[model samples]
Target: MDIPAPAPNGVQLHAPGVAALREAAVGLETAFLAEMLKSAGLGQHRESLGGGPGEGQFHSFLVRAQAEQIARSGGIGLAEILFQSLMEARK
Candidate 1:
């Protein structure tokens, strides 16, 4: 997902983008923010989890995965990939 880091010079964000690029990007941001707002509503589904089983299992899994990845790269690069992909797909 990391397109080769650009040259030493800063790469303009729209360098490889379309002719009406700003309009496209604005539409994408609108959809992205809406999706984020929709996801914010899912917090109500939280049922009290018992301490016996499935307590933070998937959450712990991701924590460990991210930890391992961070150990490799010294930071959460994968999370950046996830966020950027989510935003870019907004359109």
Candidate 2:
């Protein structure tokens, strides 16, 4: 019997050639989601609550983190479609 080589750390076992492309695609999707979240008023400070200057300064970071989490959780299928398109374009 023959043994297969071990996969590299932090690399996808499948479609290693497109790992970078996949990451780029996911990043694009994350940005898109972040913008959408911002438009939807996510992480927005309420006038009544009055989180103040600190909240205003950190709201963008909160929105970005939420967008990243959404993308990691298979966000709206955008990343997968983007990855497929990238693979096709590469070929």
Question: What is the C-alpha lDDT profile of model 2 across 14-48, one tens digit per residue?
Answer: 66566677678779999999999999989888878
Q: Where is the poorest 10-residue window by lDDT in model 1? A: 1-10
Model 1 stretches with alpha carbons more than 4 Å out: 1-19, 42-91
TM-score of each: 0.26, 0.78
TM-score winner:
2
**Per-residue C-alpha lDDT of model 1 across residues 1-91, encoded as one tens digit per residue:** 1222223234354555422443333344444443444455522223565444454445444444443434334232333343344445533
Residue 42, candidate 2: C-alpha displacement in angstroms: 0.8
TM-score of 1: 0.26
Clashing pairs in 2: none
Cα lDDT for residue 89, model 2? Answer: 74
Pairs in clash, predicted candidate 1: none
Which TM-score value belongs to model 2? 0.78
Query: Would you list the C-alpha lDDT of every candidate in the order shown?
Result: 0.39, 0.76
